[model samples]
Target chain A: DAGITQSPRHKVTETGTPVTLRCHQTENHRYMYWYRQDPGHGLRLIHYSYGVKDTDKGEVSDGYSVSRSKTEDFLLTLESATSSQTSVYFCAISDFGSGGPYEQYFGPGTRLTVT
Target chain B: SQQGEEDPQALSIQEGENATMNCSYKTSINNLQWYRQNSGRGLVHLILIRSNEREKHSGRLRVTLDTSKKSSSLLITASRAADTASYFCATSGEQFYFGTGTSLTVIP
Candidate 1:
């Protein structure tokens, strides 16, 4: 346990509504990542932050925006939720970029349903 | 995306049997890792094999990395019913990219 937490472990929202998921960490690691997992699709990166206010788009990063205001908090906002966006979102933290890096520590994950 | 392709999308085997899954990547990787995800949960790191390491063992888990083949294999010996879950192999390059994954079913 890397002291990682994700808000609203489960949620259901209407289509076209905006949703924001939050990830908080206590380790103050330099690397934080957002990933979405769907059946048969495995885990796809949505966005990752190397440090506060520094973020990068991931492979499947279209329709999603992220902000890292502090080292402990990373926020992901979906401007308009769609049914196709229904999936489990995971947040991970690691000290991968500083120098010697290792495995990622994953949070509990958030299950979002767009109806 | 550089996502690895896992062979045998789904696998079913009896308990006490050995389960094997293969992952093939495109780019040169510093290390290859294996993660296990239980239903509706986040991923858990299992083991990692470095570029120079040919094989590594952690308990019943065996991981093999072949840079020449650009491929890797994960072998779970004497699998148990609790081992039934989705197994994914990820290679780290610019970042950690996951494979298609192998769904293993260990029947009792």
Candidate 2:
């Protein structure tokens, strides 16, 4: 799992409830990303953090928010969960240096089901 | 929007044979990366090819990129049952955009 860990490996929640998923990394990489994987959509980036307190939106950032208060922790929050947001979430870390291409290492993933 | 698209959504091959998968992207990219996922678990980075580079090799895996055509191909030689997984290509520029993945089944 590349020293990356996601809390609440599996969760079942009702629509309209708030949900928060945690991604912690011991690698202390410079870049961290949150992604959701669905049957036909593959993986879609939700948000990414370049450093502590520096975050940016991704292609699929709607209905979701992210915060990186610490270097080793990145949090993804669903203000109000919806059925459409039900998917497998994954956290990935990358070292983005000049040595080589930025290869991402991913966590085991968290499965979220909204009913 | 997704930047990459892969063909032959599903592939079935016998062990000891070779497997090949293709990926096409819409726009220019700094680099392209291939990843493999077993079942529905997390993705594992396989190989990465830069735009300036033509091809790269890692163990039994070979990857080639064509910048002019905005495409790439991944070839795995002497496939084994353990190689059965979903393969995806991701393009990186300002950010990473992943394709819909190709499912490879290596029958032992």
Local distance difference test, each candidate:
0.90, 0.93
TM-score of chain B of each: 0.97, 0.97
The residue-by-residue lDDT of candidate 2 on B1-108, one tens digit each, is 655998789999999999999999998888999999999689999999988899999999999999999999999999999999999999987578999999999999
Instruction: Judge the docking of candidate 2 as incorrect, acceptable, medium or high.
Output: medium
Q: Tell me the TM-score of candidate 1's A chain.
A: 0.95
Q: Which stretches of candidate 2 lie over 4 Å from their true place?
A: A99-101
Worst lDDT run of 10 residues, candidate 2 chain A, spans: A94-103
DockQ of candidate 1, scored on C-alphas against the true complex (2 decimals): 0.58
TM-score of 2: 0.97
User: What CA RMSD would you report for each candidate?
Assistant: 1.5, 1.1
lDDT of 2 by residue, A1-115 (tens): 6899999999999999999999999998989999999998889999999999999999899999999999999999999999999999999998775634498999999999999
True contacts kept of each: 0.49, 0.67
**lDDT, candidate 1, A1-115, per-residue tens:** 6799999899999999999999999997988999999877888999999899999999999999999999999999999999999999999987763333578889999999999
